[model samples]
Target: MNQTIALIGNPNCGKTTLFNSLTGTYQKVGNWTGVTTEKKIGQYRKDKKIEIIDLPGIYSLSATSLDQKSALEFLTKTPPSVIINLLDGTNLERNLSLTIELCALNIPMIIAVNFSDKLEERGVKIDLNGISKIFGVQAVCISAIKTKNLDELIDLAKTTTQKPFKISLTAEKGENSAVKRFSFIERNLDKIIIKKGTTAQNKTQIADNLLMHKTLGLPIFFVIMTLVYFISIKLGGVFGGVIKNLFDDAGERLSIYLSEKEVYPFIQSLVCDAIIGALGGILSFLPQILILFAFMACIEESGYASRIAFLFDRFFRAFGLGGKSLLPMIVSSGCTATGIMSTRIIEGEKERKMTIFLSPFIPCGAKTAVFSFFATSIFGGNALIASSMYFLGVLCVGIFGRILKNLKVFKNNKDEFLLEIPDLHLPNLNDVYMVIKEKIKEFITRAGLIVFCVSVFLWLLKSVGLSGYVADRVEDSFLYVLGEVLKYAFYPLGFCNWQTAIAVISGSFAKEAVVESLCLLTNDVGALFSSSYSAYAFMAFILLSPPCVASLATAKTELVSNKWFFGMLAFQTLTAYTVAFIINMIGNIFVWCGGLLLSLIIVIIIAISLIVAVKILSKSKCCACTNACGERKCKNKEKHSTI
Candidate 1:
């Protein structure tokens, strides 16, 4: 008989790790909360008929955030055959509160105590038999990371039968349900848990002391991110070169083979130039993408990512976001759609929607490919230029966030930020491998499917004209006519050419297509731009513009209204254009006028103009009184005392 088991636990309690171990599927396990924003299903390795569901972590069934709501909805609506209440062995006291709540559901359960390896080191011990007897469920000590005793845990889960268990969560007068639940956990702790030795000084505290210092925290984070980019882009480029050469050689050999066979030139160009060139150009960046995600995985697994949220909380609040917003932005560096979905963890509807709207500004792996390509072709492979785009993205978020917050629609509601900081430990190589493997798979899949299809389609557009099949005269093609009309729109950004316009347009479909389209259109992408400043301007446009269609769809779903969706698109596009225009204008002044003083003066003027514009736009008449018009405070305060 097929059986489904649900793995539920508190945040950062190793539930996903156990899921990965059991199913042999890598599902983006992390050291922090909200990693699994939705339910993930995987069939057991030993019994494919039996399915394992990994639900988003929750503190209780009383759900507040969307992710928690999802978990609660699933458990109540589609009750699983057995529930594996995964507990963090190191923090059994707090974890048991959730277990107590789970017991009230009266479903068959197996208590799989995770982090068993660390329990002894932390001077904590669990009475497994006592826990089993008290809870009336099977209990086993299993290290999810180490995959220790997983078979026994699974065996117990499969064999366990439903038994009625009474949970006495009786609250005294004026006591709340939350207190009663914890009180029951406190009552049971003496019998089920044992403290063997005195606790040692926490290494996490020591590390946090230096890493999260009030003054040093932000700088440390910046330096660490800089290093991550340096290693990923600069160091990974060495390996990327090898992959690039392999593709180049393959394209050349395929071209020669097609030529020797006397194949039609159209077929030859389509196969060699469009298919091989475009797809290969994108796939060649796989090494850099993998390296980047590997570092990110390590950051997540090492538990430092949560610290970053805490460190940036105060700083982020000033811009109308809380610490939780940083996690989604960080995830955005990998994929904007996933990042947007990650915003479900935020409780406030306005904040979550605002985060979803702003997430695309942070460059995803696809946009990273575009930046890396430009940095190589135009900037002589200076990884700093590529890395600077990431920092620039963050700056855009901050600038736009402050602006958006002033608007009534996205006004800050002072959402409470509660993040659990997991214990710091060396990143598990297995988890890092899984992260890199999954990301690389995604990158390759896109290159093979979406990019490959887009490349062929673009080649057809470039090859065919009004007269038909004018492969040699690309300028006379339909694409040329289309680009000619569009190029004027981007002329002020300094890249007015048809090819660059086509690339920019294609990028809206998929960001990696920007690189793919350029490689297909021209032999030398550098020649498309007149100056490095123009190239950087184009990069900024791509970075800040509405993300690919997939991310836009996600934003639509999250925003839950067509009006907000289109507004986001218009807002992002305008932001991209304005930023690119400013960058290109400043660059032209510096280059053409050949005076740093004049450039600086222009920058100051632009900055002041922007400040004044923001002030004018954000200004609103007081709802309290008509006398408050054009005044900082309402003059007739006593007339509308409530307001």
Candidate 2:
């Protein structure tokens, strides 16, 4: 008979890490909460029949957040044969609270203490035998990262037997269950756990004091992100140029060989221009993507990500988001779909929906290709321009968040932020390798499947006309007619050419398709833009536009309502167009009015127009109540005060 085991624990207790070690799966693991927001299943490597289910990290059985609800539902509906109660060795006191809750379920369990390797460095010790004797379950100390004593843990799990253990609380009579549980833990903890000193904790505290300073914290974060982009874009570009040249040479050689071999002219264009050219342009940015993922992995594994969430909590609350929202936003930099899924960790429904609506503003890895291309070709290879797009996305999120918070639909009565900070340590090299490896695999897979298919379809559209097979006359092709019809919509934002219009439209399918379409349409991408100003406007449009089809589908599922999903789509489209139009108008002012004074006057006038527009849009329909205002208490004492 096959036995099923479930791994359950407090957030960041190394349950996912141990699952990966036992099951040999490459599931993403980080030193922060919400990394595993959904349950994952994999077979035990040693015995395939023994299934391992890695459930989302939960503090207690009380289902408050979406992730907790999922875990709770799964445990109650389908009780596993055995439960691996993973505990963080350094923070056993807090972790034991959940263990106490799980004990009430009466399921056979094995207590696996994680981070045992760090106990000595942190001046702490745990007696495994003593814990086993006290808890009435088999207990073992194991280091998931180091893969130490994992075999012993598995052995204990296989032969796990539950013993009747009752918690006798000595607290006050009216104490809550939580207080009673902690009281029991405090009374019994001294027997099995020993604390020698706080040497390691002191060092971490000293570092946090400087890094998390009130004034310096935000600036430090910006500096770190800027440096990450600098290394990823500027340094990686050197390698990208080499790859581009190789592809260019190969395309040239293949085209020549096809022509010499008397191949069909249409076939030659399809193979050389559409397939090779488009793939080359995108594949050139692989180094930069790899480097960016590496830096993100390092930040997550080094335990600085959770500190960022904590540091930004107060700041985020002002914009109607809790600090917990930052993790999803951070993950959005890689993939908006995954980021939307991560919002399950947020406790409030209003905040989670708002986060889902705003997360697509952040440029995902697909948009990274588009930005990198423009930065290299038009912006004089300045990585700052590409990196600034990220901050621009954040600015949009903040501006929209403030506006939406005042609206009745998105208003939150109270936003609570809760996060557990993990200890700082050097990133495990193996974990970093796995992250980079998985990211590369995804990138290549998309390039192979989506990009390849889109490139071929686009080539056919550009090749055939009303008369069919236009050959060299691309102006007479079917794609040109379609682009011509849509070009007028983008006239105010600059880049009114058909090619640029087509590229933007294709981006709705896949953001990377923007770059692929552009490469497939024209040999000189710079020629599509009239000036650098127009290029910047186009880039801004891409930055703020609704994400790709997959992301839209994800938003629909996450939002769980057609009305809100369509509202989000409309909001994103309008925001993108309005921002891009403003940028283009401002750039034209600088060009048309050469004098600095005149340009400044025009810019001020435009800014004033924008301010007025925002004020008008933000005007709320007041309710006849003393506290009608969503974000603030109404100043009017009379219920019939003037609107």
Indicate which candidate wins on lDDT: 1
What lDDT score is found at residue 361 in candidate 1? Answer: 91
Task: Candidate 1: give the clashing pairs.
Answer: none
Worst 10 residues of 2 by lDDT: 626-635
Q: Write the per-residue lDDT of candidate 2 for residues 1-643, one digit (tens) a residue.
A: 9889999999889988999999998998888776887789999999899899999888887746667788888888999989999998988888988888887778888998998888876668788787877778888888999999998888777777674266555669799888888887888798779654465446668778767878898899989988987787777778888998998999999999999999999999989988888778778878877887888889888888888888887667667787878878887887887788778768778898889888888888778878988997788888788878988899889888888888899874366566777777788888999988897888788778777777788889999999889987989999999999999999999989899999998888878899889878887999899888889999999988998877888888888989999999988999999989988887887788767956678788789868866864565545555455542335553654553
Total backbone collisions for each predicted model: 0, 0
Show the colliding residue pairs in model 2: none
CA lDDT scores, all candidates in order: 0.85, 0.83
- Model 1 error, position 182 (Å): 1.8
lDDT of 1 by residue, 1-643 (tens): 7899999999889888888889988888778877877789999989998899998888888656667677877878899999999998888878887887788787899888888888877778789988977788888898988999999888888888955377777788888878888887888887888665446678888898989898898899999998987787776778878877888899999999999999999899888888778766777778777888888889888999889989988768667888888888988997898789878767777788788878899998889888988887889978788879988899899889989999998863657777788889999999898877777777777777777778889989999999988877988899989999999999999989999999988988889899888877888988889998999999999999999877888888888889998889999999999999999988888877789767678788789869976875565656666454444466766675554
